[model samples]
Target: MGSNFFHHPNGWVGTTPWWKDAVFYQVYPASFKDSNGDGWGDIPGLISKIDYLHQLGVDVVWLSPMFESPQKDMGYDISDYQAVYARYGTLEDVDQLIEACHSRGMKLILDLVVNHTSDEHPWFKESRSSKTNPKRDWYIWKPPRYDSDGNRMPPTNWRGYFAGSTWTWDEQTQEYYLNLYGPFQPDLNWENAECRAAIYEVAMRFWLDRGIDGFRIDTVNKYSKRTDFPDAPVTCPGVPDQPAPEMWCNGPRIHEFIHEMQAQVLAPYKAVSVGELSNTPLPKQVLPYVSAAARELDMVFEFSMIRLGTGNLFHGKYMYTPFPLSVLKRHVATWQTFIEGTDGWHTVFCENHDNGRAVSRFGDDSTPELWEASAKTIALWQATLTGTLFLYQGQEIGMRNMPASWGVEEYKDVESLGFYNEAVESGDEKRVQAILHGLRILARDHSRVPFQWDDSPNAGFTGEGVTPWMRVHDQYRELNAANQLGDPESVLGFYRKALGLRKEHRDIFVHGAFKLLAPQDESLFMYVKESGEQVGLGADGNRKKALVVMNFTSRVQRCPAISGALGCRKGDERLLVSTLRSGLARGRVEELRPWEGRVYLNFQP
Candidate 1:
């Protein structure tokens, strides 16, 4: 169902959907935990941790792909939509997982990778069998082009997400098939009604029927591509195949296909749909997909917040550059204000399976002294925002980037490996070093390390003497969950308390009106959230208000006075939480320590 709005005593108040205030926890299956000593995390391992997740106050669990695949793109290249990957577990294990999550009042959502299928998939195999096969149109295939010297070339000069050309020639069929991602994963032809029907039956209905609460759609905006097969304009200099997001992303029929999926599967089951709308930056462009009136998706993940410091070169996002904190503040304010009172909703997240650790990327993770404080600061920043908050695995315990000493050989992510291979082939040592530095700061594999359960071997991710599929972070001995379980000042403890506060004051933190304070401050991020009487709720004349102030740098900064905005005098506000645990219960915070954050509840005059 869509958002419902009604008139209250003070004004109009919008009633949020169930997911609006929910806390989502995303688990990268292979890296979360391992059972059976197989060195790979599975459904059983997840089932065993249900109590821990519930204790962490998570409302929904979003799992990355666990479907049958060739493990080409980390289970993204699905070979069978209806079957579970053997390494992850069987169909029965998934059923048990559903039961376990539902028993605790938590919902489970799977990552839906429908943009492409593994080349080894039976349908793709049949389609490539011959030129006139009945299933030939199941995937996008076009005739090859030739140069003046009779050198055969692919259909278009569009680069794949992993690298190289988007088109891969099929020797048997004598045609080039389009694969926006890896060559082993062929894109489906959404224009074909039969193909669309098949995808809905297996990918959507199959999972929804199996009791999955909803889906986190992968590459949702890249389904429909320009059919004319035009060469991409040279955007990055010296690159033969240019990135053509403009032609593929948000194509003409993208909405139509999403609406169809909504009607056929999601709406019927009343399932939550959070689309990964990559390359769609503007809030206006994302509005149509998530607006209540559209009947498409419930929300979407926007990349603008995460791409803050990257550039426009060929190594985009893999190149690191320092950006002013004001730019990040402006982007957050813009999105928050744009959707403040609209039917559209947004997803608030900084860390996921795709990005570097939040603490390392955004917070000061330079020393042991700053780790917990900075992680708690990031947590407070996310908790106060107006959207569905997502916490990736290991974020609660302050997991960080892989150690700088490790080389490219330690990286297991396809993107990181591809970038390294390409960089080294150029024989430019300085350029390679620069790219490696960026990888150390921004590689996706940084987030894929095994979960640190305790100081035990392999971070307790796998049994002793069993090497995990990926290496555990080196700091696990000091940063595992067990070490922080009892310490109230630990990042895990702070997250539980912060999430509990958000739940306790759902109206104020979830549906409250947001106002940015000290917007131009380079070293501080401060905002106010007011609900209840101010937002047309609390007919009994009760008003709820909260003020959040954060120091974004390693140096102390004076917190700008927010007492005026909260309508409370200095020292009259109740201190709810602070990163430092300074033991001050109620007072005006005049100064904030390095990487410090504090929240307060305002007193009514």
Candidate 2:
């Protein structure tokens, strides 16, 4: 009956300047829209779609890399830090994109790939030309070891993030270049203060000067490295892989580097940073970036749920295993405890440009009706959680996973290809199947599919005969945003309603304590959000309190037992929204239909 408490030493919970309670929509520019009909998406095309995002009820937009690149890893390979890819558009086009987003009251978060750059980058080109080049120390380069046969060997046993050896021999320099990811994505030497300062200066000025929002720091955890450069002791053997990237990931001075960057660049601008700290655990590893004291990153995108294993027998070895529902509960619980105790912020998302669709990954896709209910239920969960909820473009309409039949040829992700090659070379059919199983669930290419704007030809992404860089999902005909916008009960509508709830009651949902009242029940995910008397725009506009309840299963499930509140009798429950079934008379105890969710007012106003 008491209001939920909020502890804020800095400022009001929801009134922070950097997107404290906003919903973010991610745009993978290459697949978002195409203006010149050049068969690829560009910035001008994104500018044309700002209206769509506004209507979708999002206040922040996170764009995948638009920097000038060789398209080797899509746009993740940066060739020019300040320039925009001509294929996507010019620098003018990027400037216009930022302008248009702000004009609509939306913030743009640029994706910064500082961990590595394309080999063709002028800096890298010069560094690799000769051992004594002026930029030779710009990247992580070392002399090769003379083997027993007098042949030079790689300096260490570091594994490439994209597969193969982390060290690539450079014939010109007679040395080896350190590559954490693809061979072309040579690692930057953060130990070199000059290299670090140059990138920070460019990034800060590029945005601070233009008044852009902030950045989504790509692989922010991977910038630091050990001085010894010792080989990682293999935990899982026969997998001649980088034994442990701990030697390089989250190194000694990463925090210092980030703090310096924050002091010079982010803090002055009051900008947001969503650090992409993949392959790292939350709470222990990811939470520091968003701590109030760190002042480094505003939020961190944790990948616990996104790494779940699908129904693949060979999931773990290939890193594609659908984690069970229990794993989801444990992860969420861990995050909730940390945020509740600290002045830390978290980013909530089911899908991004890097993971598979939510409904397909988490839903019990045995039937269509369950799919619909599950989608709405998940959206309700996303809305109520105390963080910035990011919805991938197609997620609004409940898009499912790419076809199971999609072969290796249909995939474009470097990670997936590398795993496949490793599996095939091992000559183990069982391992190959297991690896592909994991790839089916976690590959970045899943969320990179074209936006399902309408049921038009090619999902209206490109003209006929102009094949997209990746295959357009076939479900676009039935699942595009155009049709859903008009339907009251569509997934798109449910998302709009979810955002509307946050907009209507930002205090409680965004800034209040999150308690899972019924976490163990297999049928439901019930929780409550309570804001103190000083709070406004929470679950209860009145000084009264509100209780949030959701039924994750598809069956009429009753609350175990309660005294102060029952189902609907006494007008005690003001049903705000329901996914499966609604309409209950006052003073009656009842059950929730399968896959149903409802928010109720707990006390009298």
Candidate 3:
């Protein structure tokens, strides 16, 4: 089916393909594993884990940047567009990993980062050399302006996504360069047709030739910027846009770029594409990108829930407001309702390498029992929803947040460093402490901490005397995989059970309609998915239907009784799986143990 057809949710109306329900697992390469003991994870390391992913029961594997990079921004700072990083082994290693995933009946989704390029990249090198160079127009450049006092002024007021000014003055070219990220990462000028075409070509041929199932485009909507580069009105006190970022983010030409990408590249292969839409409001501008015309993406990841910890001052000053569950449920419910009747698809995620653990954010991770239950409940809630569920590494094992004691030296994320420097440089010790503490709760390193495969040193990710790039969590001794695989109540086991239900009841869970019930309850997060007589892809034609009730609050609570279509007396229902007990009597209105949840299979009214 064509890209345009993806917008209609009516199960591929008029030859459009349907992707309403799928599961994607995000893999961060460097922290994933180390095959050659270099202290960094590689592709061969990934090839060894294909079976593990298959066992986890995910349909897609979304690998983080493996493209050549300077490691300045981890792998997000790309130096080469086409070549695989040598530290990750040869291109053949990637080929082998792709084949392994496909052989197990799973698809691979490459992380496509097109927003900016590393300063070390050859294209940037040539473009920044001289004003008259043929590649000069490839990046956003501007002539410096002199202030009334003769001091040079930036062309615009835009600040970097990290921190600092977005413009860098280069005496050599006598021009200022535009960068929404770090100085080393230069934003490409999408207005330049040559540059745009080059990016599209690179995105196309790689997946087309290599047989990748799709792509998860990172910072995708930022590809287009405002034309005039008008100065943004002040929103925050310190963070001002030089001609504002609003002028640049989601520019007028964005749809054109998406349409071109779809027409020239994505459409021909019938490949799936999802944009990582940052700072963009949902059910409005973001939704159109994934609209029925298929002009751009298969789905877009809206970050409202991810930004919960930020409060009102999200990116500016800091606060310790533990994200409220009410706020989380509201945003999720609104988004789900907005796309409930659309052909456009939604990409669901609770954790990613760039964020902290969901187990820590949503549940009590300090204790083993609560940790296991919370992790299981989160997995089921996301998986059973009506979109592509994205699971981050270490999530299956219910990884916790970074240790509060991990000081500056132990951190590797740029966001952490930027906040640390800003806090100290500005002499706000109290604010610094708060930001650092928040980092412990929200930074990507918490998720990137070494995968606890076993109780071995370095959490089985590296050997002794080999320093890891980041500190591994200290709980590896007790929380490692070797122990969890034996315990059915472990977080890993609960994940298996959750994924198993998703796979086993594909028609009801994967492609079924999501009916969110009891939205306002603070203690109970309840919902039901009705297959309504649709048959799964490979089943014996038996209809599948289920009622999934999750108790989000960490206390015993009574879920709202189900009537109408779902037949249940008072509350007598067989417990399919529970963190505390085995059998549940019908119409009993049983108590839900703290952080506990249950699902009933073939439940009838």
Q: Indicate whether candidate 1 or candidate 2 has the larger lDDT.
A: 1
**Tens digits of per-residue lDDT for model 3 on 1-605?**
43223222323223324444457888898888888888998888888888888877777888889889998898788998788888887778878888888888787878888888898888888999998888899998999778789988888877776777888988788899887878888888888999878887775567568888778888888888877777778766654443255766688888888888888888788888888888787587777788866567888889888777763332552455765566677887767666656767677788887777888877778777677778878877776766667888888888888777768788788866886687788787887887877777777678888888899889888787788777788888988777788776677877888777665555566556666666667777776666644434233343444677778877777755544324544353444555542443333455667777777655432
lDDT by residue (121-188, candidate 1, tens digit) is 99999999987888899999999999999999988888887778889987777889999888999999
Candidate lDDT values, in order: 0.86, 0.75, 0.75
Model 3, global lDDT: 0.75
Give the range where candidate 3 is weakest over 10 consecutive residues by summed lDDT: 3-12
Clashing pairs in 1: none
Highest-lDDT candidate: 1
Off by over 4 Å in 1: 2-15, 532-543, 582-588
Angstrom error at residue 148, model 3 = 1.9
Ordered from best to worst TM-score, the candidate numbers read 1, 3, 2
TM-score of each: 0.95, 0.91, 0.91
Model 2 lDDT, residue 580, Cα: 50
**Model 1 TM-score (2 dp):** 0.95
User: What is the C-alpha local distance difference test score of candidate 1?
Assistant: 0.86
Error in Å for residue 466 of model 3? 1.9
Q: Once model 1 is optimally superposed onto the true structure by TM-score, how far is the C-alpha of residue 383 displaced, in angstroms?
A: 0.5
